[model samples]
Target chain A: EDKVVQSPLSLVVHEGDTVTLNCSYEVTNFRSLLWYKQEKKAPTFLFMLTSSGIEKKSGRLSSILDKKELSSILNITATQTGDSAIYLCAVEVLFGFGNEKLTFGTGTRLTIIP
Target chain B: EPEVTQTPSHQVTQMGQEVILRCVPISNHLYFYWYRQILGQKVEFLVSFYNNEISEKSEIFDDQFSVERPDGSNFTLKIRSTKLEDSAMYFCASSEAGGLAGMETQYFGPGTRLLVL
Candidate 1:
């Protein structure tokens, strides 16, 4: 079965701390890896990584894909209390007839303390 | 920024009852999708729709599930018969393109929580 596993299912960090969340997947016909920040109800778009080694960065968040190892990492620097939420990693793969689907991981719940 | 929107943030129903989840995808999006996440479980793909027809569906999308784009902007998912196991948070998503190999970003809606008793 296609699988996406996230490590350290839960993490607690203090403000100003830096943390890394890991995700690894084993699936057929990999297309891209996406990261999302799920706060109350929606899983807000974060970054989508398709190339290996080259990193995608936002204001304080960044992610990189490692196709060689079938893994990805999300890094959040200088975390704040508002960063407390479930970080999700979803792998997009091609389906039959040119369709696409996103296989999501259980997600890493991060709690940032002030 | 355009965002997908869903109705009935929460719903309560009895087993075997029918339920219809409503969604309004971003106006310019051409593709639509439905996903569900049971409590404490990972979000799962249910179906994808494009051009008023289903493009792809996962194994979980059985005979009990159906989708339709009644109007130009509204997409709907209907459950013929709800089951206790079917209670979950359903999310609607949309993308400007098919997200095939070109990598189109899919924007998701705030999900609707359903409970089957």
Candidate 2:
């Protein structure tokens, strides 16, 4: 079955610390990988990576896809209390005719204490 | 910036009762999708709609599930008969062009939490 797995299921770190979350997937027709942050409700988009070795960054959050290893990583630097949330990784697979679906990991619960 | 929107932040219904979840995607997006997260479980894809027809669906999207774009501005997911297992946070998403060639990203809604008892 197509699947996504995230490591370090949960983490706790002091504010200003840097953290890294991991995600790996085994699937067919992989098109891209995306990261999202979920606080109280739905997830907010973070980064979407398609090319290996190329990193996508926004503010303190950055992500990279290693297609050769079928894995990706998300890095949050200078974390703040507001950064505490469940970070999700999802793999987008294509089904022709511009159709697609996202297979998501259980997500890494990040707790940033101030 | 335009974002997807869903109605009824919360809903509680008896088992076997039908429920409809509503969404309004970005005006320019052409592809719409439905996803759900069961409490601590990962977010799961339920179905994807385009041109008013289902383009793809997961195994979990069974006979009890249906989708429609009732009007030009709204997309809906209907569960014919709710089961206890159906209680979950259902999220609505839309994308400009399914992001081929890394062109666009799927925009997610705030989600509607459904409870069936």
Candidate 3:
């Protein structure tokens, strides 16, 4: 079975602190890794990492994938209360004949204190 | 920015009852999907549809579950008999391109919370 594991299931930090969320996966025919932020309802797309070493960044948020280690890390710098949410990491894998599915991690719950 | 939309944000049904969950994927998207998330659990893929046919489905998408693109726009999932284990938030998503070469970002709906008693 394909599995994606996330570390530090829950975290609480004061504003302006930096935090790193980790995700590791074990799967076959890897296609890509995606990150999402879930606030109250649906999850919003954050980043997609397909290659190893190269980091994808958006403003204060950045992510890097390490294929050699079978893991990825999402880093948030100078976090604010608005950054509080569940961060989800999903690994996309090809099953057969062009079919693909995303296996997701349990997600890391981040709470930013003011 | 266009977004996927789903109806009946919440539904409560008794065991053995049939229910249909509706979704309207982004108009320009070609690939559609259905996923579910149990409370405090990971989001799980149920099925993926393309060209008006089922391209792929997961083990969790059993015989009781069916998907249809009734019209040119509306996509629906029908559960023949609801079970307590079926209680979860059903999310609808769509992507602009096929999954062959990656670069497809799935935009998800807010999701419908289903409770089977």
The whole-model lDDT of each prediction reads 0.93, 0.93, 0.94
Q: How far in Å is the alpha carbon of A83 misplaced in model 1? A: 0.5
RMSD of 3: 1.0
lDDT of candidate 1 at residue B32, scale 0 to 100: 93
Off by over 4 Å in 3: none
lDDT of 3 by residue, A1-114 (tens): 899999999999999999999999999999899999999888899999999999999999999999999999999999999999999999988766656778889999999999
A1-114: candidate 2 lDDT, tens digit per residue: 899999889999999999999999999999999999999998899998989999999999899999999999999999999999999999998888677888999999999999
- lDDT for model 1: 0.93
lDDT for B8 (candidate 2): 88
Q: What is the Cα-based lDDT of residue B97 in candidate 1? A: 81
- Model 1, runs deviating above 4 Å: none
Task: State residue B80's C-alpha deviation in candidate 2, in Å.
Answer: 0.8
Candidate 2 runs further than 4 Å off: B99-102
Alpha-carbon deviation at B31 in model 2, angstroms = 0.3
Can you write out model 1's per-residue Cα lDDT over B47-77, one digit (the tens) per residue? 9998778998889999999999998989999
Query: Fnat per model, in the order given?
Result: 0.73, 0.75, 0.68
